[model samples]
Target chain A: MATNIAKIACAVAFAAGVAAPVTAAAKSSTVTAIEERGTLLCSGHNGSYFGFVEVNDKNEWKGLDIDMCRALTTAILGDPDKAQIVPLSWAQRFPALQSGDVDVIIKATGWTMGRDTEVGLQFSLPYFFGGTQFMAHGDLGITEAKELDGGTICVEAGTTIERLAGNYLKTLGIEHTMVSYEKASELRAAYLANRCDAFAAWGPFLAVLRATELEKPDAHIILSDQLSNEPIAAAMRQGDEEFVDMVNWMIAALLIAEEEGVTSANVEEMASNPPNPKIARLLGVDPGMGERLGIRDTWAKEMIAATGNFGEIYDRNLGEGSPYKLERGLNNLWSHGGVLYAPILD
Target chain B: MDAAALKLRRSRRDMLVQTLLVVFVVLVIWVAISTAHTNLTELNMTSGFGFLERATGWSYSFSLIDRSIDDSYSKTLLIGFLNTLFLGLICIVLSTILGFAIGTARDARQLGLNSLATVYIQIFRNLPLILQLVFWYAVLIHMPGPRQAFTMGEVAFLSNRGLMLPGFNVSPTVVLAMFAAVVLLAVVIFRQKSLQPVQKLLLWLVSGSGAMLLLAWIFAPADSSIFSIPAQQGLRFRGGIGVPIELVAMILAITLYGSAYIAEVVRGGLNEVPSGLTEAGKALGLSSRAIWFHVKVPMALRTIMPPLGNQWIFIMKATTLGVAIGFSDLFYIVSTSITQSGQTLELMGLLMLSFLLINYSLAQLVNFMNARLALKGH
Candidate 1:
């Protein structure tokens, strides 16, 4: 008789435990919770993704994605080191965001119509533009993707590149088989071991892989054909327009800083001695932008001082300052031949 | 113990407790549904199985059934499910046979065989399954390409692309003859109650050999060939069974890895069988083979059944790791679909249902075996 009463009590307790979280989540905003926690939880790649997200020799996270997380955290909390990156597989990233396990996803996530409309997440503006391409051993003498006909291509599974490469090969009338791996490192290992004739991935990512991870960079070359556009962006949980606006404006601030010739080293000097009205407003010398976004006036200035302008961040992680040595082709400012442009900092 | 006494002793506390338990369960379920509804509504997404009818624009390299890129998502999932079942069933059969062999070898008196079995168990058992899978896959991938593949006298080929083996396209006559032979064998076996054991055996062998000869006679291309060997055509092998290297690697890793644990179980079962039973069999004037078949095996099997069934279940679960090596098992396909469609919750539900069905069937089968083998009184 007593055991029956105990069972009833246990059931009631379990029910209460299950129902408590819903009420708690309903009461507080996710942004406020992140702010209170002080650390900006970010989802990124588990395996080294070359210039995007990887562990350095010192075991510290160092990459373009990590810098983006730092920039977002600095804009929000006025501190860059408060950013914490949680590495996740490509399949786990969206689920992790939806479950609120991470505050934002600074992984090199591509923005797509299906993803935006179907998945319960919103993407910020495109921070980087890349396209699907192929890389093969230089000894193969294959200059283009069409040359990989009737050959196997190695790709990463559960990624856009897999679909892109598959579709592209179909269009090229090639009867090819794809062996996709779950992890980036495994894909590279299989390709390097000559298991696959070509490796399909984004152009910049392939460049990073070749320049940084390969035994000999000159031994392989990425094909110049751009099969599909991949506008990479940061993702955040939906239903928080404020948080979305905050992240979007943070990315825009970097582009605007590049336009205004603001570097991490020169941000403080530029803020103190404004060369133009737009620069004055951008550095928060004259407030209004951050107030509208429900953040502090010094948000852009803090972000710039921490991670530098878009050009500087690109150069440091994926361009001349890094081993990838990628030029700012399509990623350059709009005034140049490239298409990267920021809205006027009114 | 009487029903009247039980009814008279029913307390109000028991009734209240039962009520509370039901209420709690209902409340928990209610909360879960409402929360999911709220989240889906906020996301502006519809929840249902309507997406199953949509065409899967992607193509899979390997499928157990005939499928194309234009197939529906439901068909894709079914193919993935079948592939997973195929791998699981193959691994289970292979591992069981290998485990029994190794287990018997371990129990044997010879030091060389025993040491070899022990070394195999130790090595496979120590390494992680995923790491082993990746390693095997890497080895296969690094093998020579199609032009320089290792071949078996033009009958079979092994390359980094895959292994190709001679496949059969049985003629109508061969199929009819095989069916007729099976019926004939059944009839002969049924009528064998009046015949001597040697006569029965002779009848079986003649029928089997006749069936084989009939099939062999139909092998030539009078109308169409019964068997055809694979031949290289351009960059691909044509007219043969092409097994992907991914599948080979997955199966090899799962079988070899699962056999290690199953071997240990077999060894433990063998050790648990008392020597006194064998002594008793011998005292009863039973031969050594009779003692082993009657006493040792039955005794060992009674102990081995539960753990062996558990190992089988473990193997099925391990087939999910096939995703690492690009074998399009159910989990891998569902995960890829979720990534493409962004229907995590719905696809996860489907995945859970698939695994649950498989596990439930295995559990039922195991329970039935256990009941059949159970001691009479127990």
Candidate 2:
């Protein structure tokens, strides 16, 4: 009863906070809708997808994709705290975005051709690169994926991993059974219980599960086999070019900052010191681009202070600083032997 | 007011209400269709049933019909429908038997047995079915692998993969002889008025023994084995009947959960029977067993069945929860297809239609049984 009362109180306080900006947001571009409301509505996973999205012990949402929401909110509304994460299932994600229930979705959604063309949503530049990877019990003397011939593979339903595993095994002429669960956590549990011979998921997600969720980390081995590329990106409703452009550039700023050797700790100093013409332009040393994007002169700097550069976000949520300790393999900067690149500020 | 003026006012009011209702219903449908159309167009989505012909591109773990991953979606949905129906029917039968036993036990004179039944109903009824399914699934999956399964002699084995039991491959001659024996026994029993008791007993013993000998003789063939036990081959148990662990867990959880509700229904119906009926049976010189069975049971059944019918429908709906524990039923398969094909509306329509057909058939059966039970003494 106390909890229910507390919940009602919180809801009342939140509604009171939202009332003023909502009337101001009624007639404007979606960007103004976000700015006036002082909140960036983001759709994310209902449960922890490990490093992608999860609510922490402090009752705050945390993860790499969540950091993206923080970045965009800080860039647009100038307040990192002005962001709301709406939990959604895989099937619910697109519908929620289409219904305007959410401003954007940064829930490790794979940018598919079908979704791009058929779904009523627009995707930002790929923020994370992943692929379907297989993990097997270390007790099984299987070193290669081909060794899993005729083995049952556990996977989450309605995911690319299911189709990828099926197609990959079929190409090898290896007949296998696939048991699909609705949630990733359920799939992981089944795998832990020895229900399947191999567990298939995105490489980074599997890494996070093995590193953190497992009691015996070394008991499982993720094979180095890549089944299909899964380029994760953010999605929003179409017909809002200003909102789309703003979202895209927020992603680009992170990459550009990383390229310019600007860390969140050093961004303020870089803005005053004027490291180079490119860095200066990115930091709004000569401010005009902010006006063009309809943001503040120090928008990029504020965004960096709120979250961090792409590398910092990656390291903090998924890499060296996180339990997963995933290396920025294909997600590294373009100049660093990876595919990620930001267009020049010029 | 006079009668003519009052009647005219009443007709006008009735006409106004009828017109308003028709307009309201049409407006609702129009809004619904337009919203769907606008949403689809804005999202750039195509709507049709043509995708059903496309290959499923994934295989299910358990299927009643022979199907490959490359089969059409229609065929996949059919396989899923059959699996759901199979599980639903099995749970209904098992839960009914368990329910009656527990209900009777709850009413038993033995204090210990009554308490035991009470505890079962409390535990299962209070807990949700999904949680029970996951719990049972976890327990099953933690069992030893196929190679090191807990074995029962050479005929049965239990493992994380499934339960394997002995399968019989009887010869045609043995089956025919068994049928002939059944026919002879029926003839002797039906003619009991003409035949002596000794004659009837003698005939039964002869036919039964002849059927047994015939089965033994047929099984003595040196060329083929009649009884096949599952053997561990590679990573799986092969040869005998293999019941997947998921299916077992789903059935166990569903039956246990459903039987609790069924027990309550039965207990309520039985208790509602008048004590006078039992006293009347005693006055008529009926045994206790006969009094309960012939007098009270039939009376309770009329009350028991309607609620039991409701419980049956509940079980049918609960079968969809099998998807949570990786039991591949119709709802699970369609949900998977929706995620893959991005055809949510069409697939959902198909799922609802299939369930509607299934539940309607079940309701019809329940109604038929209820009607028969509603009739009196005959």
Candidate 3:
């Protein structure tokens, strides 16, 4: 009887402890409406590479990934800066979302069944795509990854790249030891220091390292190995279909922006008077579809204004202005013979 | 009341309270453990020590163990423990010597030498451990490759990869000479302790240097071929013993950090001796050294042993940071284990226990020493 009372007392105390924050987050996640204020809690990468989540000299966060986070903010709050970026590591990212640390995860996280079913996080449209590639210092004359029959390869520890590197090496009948590092930065350092004969990292990161590490800047090359698929995209926890729909539609709309020649500079004008009926309807000229998503019809327009159109954001971060200087291969628009497809906004 | 009756009552009351406390603890443990068990189980997480038997199928980038992915988790854990011990032993030995030097130098009355000691401590303390590890791994290890090493008369080869030195070969003559040299060195030291001042100092220096030279010259021809490490080899650098850069850098950092504190402890020990003892030595017509050997060192140890233990424990923890520098110590092995075996919970538990053993055992050892050195029987 006494022990039961003690257990009851402890349960009551624990319940009391979790009561307030749970209530607040519960209110924050109420359906599709705003929680308390005009804000959207978006999570992002603390450190990835280049256009995704590059750190400047002052240690400030800004990149294409930041643009993706801003889009969600503008979608709900009519302002992009309202989104808060909660940069998380690969290990911490899933736990952060499952625990409601943020409303969404817009980091360069890959979509997979194990993560989806196991962690209960739902994937949105792919914001970008990349694959693993083999890179080496140009002087090694190792233009292809297959030539590394008796060489050393470097990869980030505890990542998919380790397994992919192993499988690819096996396929190529190569005999190489995979030197795993805890972080991409360490792997890059080791590769540059010539500790390893070759580097196995994502292609975009290879481009970034090339821009930074190489003397002639073409001193390293990322071979067309395509070791594994990295279908990188945004994610939110399960049981938030309203939030999912809002984010998904906005993505489709952004892809349509590319299809309809909508630049960040031209987005505002396009929103005011989009020529086509579908674009007009999407701009909320005909009838506000925002009513269904519990927002004003001009929500996406607000998102675009805060950042830019999909094409503008892409060009700024991964294109000529950025150090990555990626050539928009698979990430380009449908009209450009790429995989980025957008359904009719109507 | 009678004395026996009073003692019986007290004992009974003590037993009742102890029983109640045990019951209380048991209940608390029950709740916490049940909560963890239920939550983890419901979350489809299995927890057991059975994961130790599973094969950890993966290749290590850098490790102390020749691990196949086929090595069991238990083997991985043991490898991790050994790595920790390797780093710990090296760091502890270096720190003890470095700490003594730094500690003594701190008490040196000279302005420049004292300030240099101060500067050494300050500069190292100011830098973050991780940054230092990176700098060591990158800048220090980036020195010379295997072939491009700097050789000093073929006796010493310093490279970015390692520092190579000629370790003596163990032929019967060489071994016998070294053994004799050690015995003679000890006898000379002990005899010098009791001899007259000027004569003792002269004999100690002469015999020590002479014995060292005699052995060196006697073994010179054998040393030329057998003792001296061959500078040239086809693939692996042969003959010369190679000490890895990772080992050097970790030892250097741990010793540098540990020694500063050891120096401070040493200074405190030196300061603990009353000035009157030295004055008494002068009054009794004794030299300055006699008072120090008897009065100061004994008392200083009482103050020194505790903090020295704490510094060693810090070293044990600091070895974990060796993972950052590619030294496959406890943390590195645990990480590799977790990734390869997928036994996150079991590996985590093992990691915690391994570190706890190292730290707790070190504390126990220090405590034992402190007790031995404590003022005899209160």
Candidate 4:
């Protein structure tokens, strides 16, 4: 009789232990949980991915994606410093967000239909645009990707580029082998060691590597043909419409700030004195914006002040203000001959 | 004093305890699975094995079987399993042979051989397997590329790309038949102790050639050649067997690392053999070589089987480290599958089941071998 009682007690305890987390997760909205926890969790890259996500000499996370994470934290909790960065690999980011280990993935993740539909994740607007391309050793004398037939190409595993490269090469009837590494550093090392004839990755990252990593940048050539043009975005869990809307508008506010010439330096002054109703509404000079989004009206103001507008972030990270010196290309605003256009602020 | 009654009471209690324990386990599993299902439903993610039929748009550096980007996830995973099994089997055979040689060298009279074996064991055993894998990979990739390959008389070529060797262009069925014939013939000859040496030789020669001719007549196509030599193509060797550097490095690292532990096991087993047995063989007018093999090795078998089985299983598990160097073993393929399909629970479950099945088979084989080697009526 005693043993039966003990067994019942153990079974009940085990059931409760398994069921506790599910109930806790279902109880609160992501925003409410962040508010209660007093910290916003955001995903960072596992290693240095130059210009996008990287660590600095001061042991602080500093990159475009890092700034984006901080901006989201500021918008949600009203304090950018409350953002905690959880470094994760490319394959780990989606599961991490789904499991609530991180609130958002701002690690320059590509938006794909399969991921959005099947992976239980939602993506914000395209914050950046890049394409997949191959870079080969100059000694190979390969100028176009088509010339890479019968060559071994290296790629980072668990990335969209791996699929794109594979399909591209196969469609062209090129008989090539592909090797994938788990880490970007390892892939780069393999390429440098000549383990593969070419390396396929994001075009901008290849450019960054050629500029910064190689002893002789001219020793490698980035192929002219591209495998894919991908839209990079911030990803969050699929549920919580309010949280997703907040993130979407937060990005719009940045683009709108850039278009209105409202720098981080002048955001405070502009918020105080309204130049126009649109700017006023965006900076929370008007009252209803934050209330509708379930956040403070001054959320955009705090975020812009913390991380600057979209143009400023891009310039500081990948454009003329940084070592990369990448041209704005399609990332520039629509009025400035680029494709980026923000939804009108009513 | 009612001992049988006490025994009956104890047995009844044992039955009750076991029944209660099983109930508790089932309840725990039900709770855990239901919780996962509820959470998955809440997250709006599908959970099932239906995703295995989807096409995988990825490719790996090497596979024993022909594969393409359009292959199904199941086929790709099977290829991955085959690659792991191939690497594991080769490493097991090579490490056992090398370990036995080194283990015997430790007991050699020559100081140089003994010291060299000791140093080899220490260095490889002390370092982590992962570091050794990376180190060997680095060494392999640093070799000359295909353009400047080290050629061996137009039959084999060694480059950073891999080792390419002459291959037989015969049907697989013919090869399998030939191998089966040889093994069967050897087993038959071993069982027939009454046969003389010349008779055994004649039987082997006649049967081997006869089986080869019969298999070729039945299975070989009209256009097939016996041998295909590797030759330089545009970027790599063509028309031959190509071994990728990742595979070579994996084999090299695992063999060296695994041999160290296995050599120690061998040495321990040999040490456990009583010196009296060796003396008795010597007194019986046996040569030293015969005595060592016939007396020491047989006696050592009982002590060696268990630890050696453990080493084999460890070597099999170590094949997963192939992922670190892009070898596309089962673990790597399943990880890629999870990333692509997002069926983590189902895919990880499959991966665990695969490893369990493979390692369990290896353990069973070892246990069988141990049973055969056990002294009878002990």
**Taking the tens digit of each residue's C-alpha lDDT, what string does model 3 give over B279-359?**
777888876566556776777789888988988898888888866766667798788667765667677878899889989
lDDT by residue for model 4 (B234-335), tens: 877886788999999999999999999999999899889998998899999999888878899899989989999999999999999988999999999999
Candidate 4 lDDT over residue span A214-264, tens digit each? 998778888866677778888988867667777888889899999998889
**Which of 1 and 4 is ahead in TM-score?**
4
TM-score of every prediction relative to native = 0.62, 0.62, 0.57, 0.69
Candidate 1 chain A lDDT trough over 10 residues, lowest sum: A22-31
Off by over 4 Å in 3: A1-131, A144-153, A164-179, A193-195, A211-215, A223-346, B1-6, B59-62, B125-128, B134-138, B141-244, B276-295, B339-342, B371-378
By DockQ, the better pick of 2 and 3 is 2
lDDT of 2 by residue, A131-247 (tens): 778888888877668888757889888777787788888888876778888887888778888888899887986888788879987788887677777788989888776677788
DockQ top scorer? 4
**lDDT to native, each model:** 0.83, 0.85, 0.73, 0.87
In terms of lDDT, the poorest run of 10 residues in model 3 chain A is A24-33
Model 4: DockQ vs. true structure: 0.55
What would the per-residue lDDT of candidate 1 be over residues A139-172, giving only the tens digit for each residue? 7777778787667788888787887888888788
Which 10 consecutive positions of candidate 3 chain B have the poorest summed lDDT?
Answer: B232-241
Q: How is the predicted docking of candidate 4 categorized under the CAPRI scheme?
A: medium
Q: To one decimal, what is the Cα RMSD in angstroms of model 3 from the true structure?
A: 13.7
User: If both were scored by lDDT, which would come out higher, candidate 2 or candidate 4?
Assistant: 4
Q: How many angstroms is residue B59 displaced in model 3 relative to the true structure, after the best TM-score fit?
A: 4.1
Per DockQ, what order, best first? 4, 2, 1, 3
